[model samples]
Target: MNHFPLFADLKGRRVLVVGAGPVADRKIALLLAAGARVVVGARAAHPRVLARAHAGEIDLRLGEFNPAWLDDAWLAIAATDDRALNRKVSEAAAARRLFCNVVDDPELSSVQVPAIVDRSPVTIAISSGGSAPVIARRLRERIESLFDHSLGALADLARRRRPAIRAARPGLRARRAFYDWLLDGPVLGALRRGRPDEAERLLDEALAQAAAPPRGRVLLVGAGPGDPGLLTLRGLRALNEADVILHDRLVDAGVLSLARRDALLIDVGKAPGGRHEATQARIHALMVSHARQGRCVVRLKGGDPLVFGRGGEELQHLRRHGIDYEVVPGITAALACGAYAGIPLTHRDHAQSLTLATAHRRGGACADAEPESGRTRAYYMGVERLAGLRAQLLAGGLAPDTPCAIVENGSRSGQRALYATLENVENQARRHAIRSPALIIVGEVAALGRELAWFGEILDGEPATAATARLAAA
Candidate 1:
């Protein structure tokens, strides 16, 4: 590193700022936050600086730059636009052996402020050696995304219990392992889930028996609708920290690739016309077994787990097994597909409410759940049963001309939206060879997709006359 990076302790120390413009005001604010005594020497000052002076937060001296300003300062900052004045400040600080930062003039600055991501007790700083500040800022943004805000709490808790932790794990290696467990295991997870008491209990439990086998837990995380970008931050963190992952087959490969490199991946997906009950039993067994072995188990499923994804059943199974678990919600297919296909499930003019159902329920049971007038209906697994759905809707006295849409692959890059009327929906499915993993939407709002659709291909399955009329209206 060309410049040594260190966090200075300036608490109650005098720091001199040469110039009181906006830039100086910003530096002074940082100085004040760091508990530094600030003395400003400038030809003029920003109104905020004057206000701070009046408030006695900073001592403002309005006059020409003076070398005497650096006499007692622990650090100096030159933020003036004038190059000569900045150089003078830099040279004076150099003569006094005081570190100085000349704003926007890296060559003259002995200290360069780095972009900071402050999770309080857990702060991260990024610098490009004063050569690429923008790059440093971008790096800071990525770090901010990767770390949870609860990290500060986790850090503080560790600090408070450091003596206990040290006593529990006397060896250096043992202490390091304990710290790793604190970071990757249930303690941090508990904090992230907003159970600080539980987190404290878990930490205490660990400290009580530091040599015992680590406790295991399960995180049921939603992978979202086929798009990795839709995955939640908590879900990503779980995947990265997982020791074992029991994932559905439909979970995106891109999502799987984000897991810990050494994590064991087990496919527990069930298929139609397959032994689903047995498969579900096996999944439950795997989750319980891995977690019992002190592994961080992730039951990764596509879309929101509770929304017809059997998440509730899995949670029930986990509870029955006495396994510690947390649920991370994902963007459900109904919402993701509706947004991607530009079909608002509920619109003021077209639809007042939305009904979600599955097509495979016996005896046309889902038909009873059909949306009323001025409402929209979405079927999760109906692409294969479109003809039966159409017939059921007709038998239920629904309008033959009701707009329908089939959203395939939802938010994926290859997603497609096929539009048709209730009467012709079956025909359109047959013509387009529509497949499973598609959502079916029915209502007047489905018709608005043709006009509002922005992402993916839109296929019109309406009759030529109707299509011509709609196009003319547009």
Candidate 2:
């Protein structure tokens, strides 16, 4: 941020170059591309430079360094092999107050050329002044990998259709949201295949259907637990189509970034163990209001909505209001936490059955929760109610010696884990500093960590082993 950003107007401006070597040749190319009329002031030219002069692309002068070269020039470059000559060019340009770049010499130059990524109409330039051109070039190479050339064409198409979209949506927010949908949806494919026309046609069709701007439809989208990548394609489609996203506290930011930029993001999240009625009511209104006005609304929820994610309740509300809606299933907490953490929900030697139960609240106390019969049980949000969960499981005849594991921040970078028997699960989890966004498993199959742990080994850079606590902290 040391230097302010500026764009120079080069069209038809004169550029004077004091060398015809590779360095000067590069400067000449950039100037010519910017449409600057270039004059090479060197006595002899490289074959390429001589060719360019003969082809009338540049005006070549046969002479030693001369101060008169700066007379009518907007910019000048001193790229000669002789440092004395380069210094002379610098002093001449400075006296005349003209911008000058002395090749590879920062102290004598007014400006330094930068490494550039040009997808014309979408150019990215990286510069370290003249201090580190190598670093600048490396960064440019990295940036060049992030965006494809098709983006320029895609942007052009959108620009070309601005008038039509304005006529169709009228509202600024609506128009912006429509473009967001296009960028996140099939338009990218069209642009990649060199089908801008088809992409434009499809977009026009979608906009035309917006005769009323596709009314808000409630989509119960599962933002697969905490791992953003686990979200389903259908869920991604819902997010892209949404005009608003009503999310909970548990939904990851990485997942939310996939939402339309202009979409209204409403955080209806509740505290752990807090009431959800008000949140649900507010979500209901946003969905209904936008839908009534013909907006695509997305009710973004973490984990599989049907599996204790209260997705059914939202669906029920949408149904009662007669709102168009559908559910996009996300990777459930039970499967995601256990799988990514290297815990097998069902193992051949120890677990013959799998079960999932909420540990947060059950009718009043965890004691009131139903006992799931299985070799393994994944308790969601159950840390605070662990004692109660243990009692309920013991009461249901589960063995106290059963292996149990806790996985926190499953599949996220800071994931932690703890492994212990059912009798010591809560205690071990506490000692190991297990926190929320965690899943607890109790059953013989949990002991299968003696084998099936892949993610844990990858994380610690160790070979797979029975003692890796694979599922607990993976």
Residue-pair clashes per prediction, in order, are 0, 10
**Candidate 2 residue runs with Cα over 4 Å from true position:** 1-46, 53-161, 172-213, 365-374, 448-474
- How well is each residue in 1-474 modelled by candidate 1, as lDDT tens digits? 588889988999999999999999999998998899999999999999999999999999999998998878999999999999999999999999999999888999999988899887777889887889899999998889989899999999999999999888876546766898998899999999999999999999888873855678999999999999899999998997788999998899989999988889999888878998899989989989988887789999989888888889999998998999999999999999999999989987768888888887655565554437888988888877777788888788788888889999999888889988898988888898877789999888888788788999888898657844643553
Error of 2 at 147 (Å): 9.4
lDDT of each: 0.88, 0.77
Query: Deviation in angstroms for 60 in model 1?
Result: 47
**How do the residues 39-92 of candidate 2 rate in per-residue lDDT, one tens digit apiece?**
999967899999999999999998887888777998889989999889999999
User: Lowest lDDT 10-mer window, candidate 2?
Assistant: 457-466
Please give the lDDT score at residue 406 for candidate 2. Answer: 76
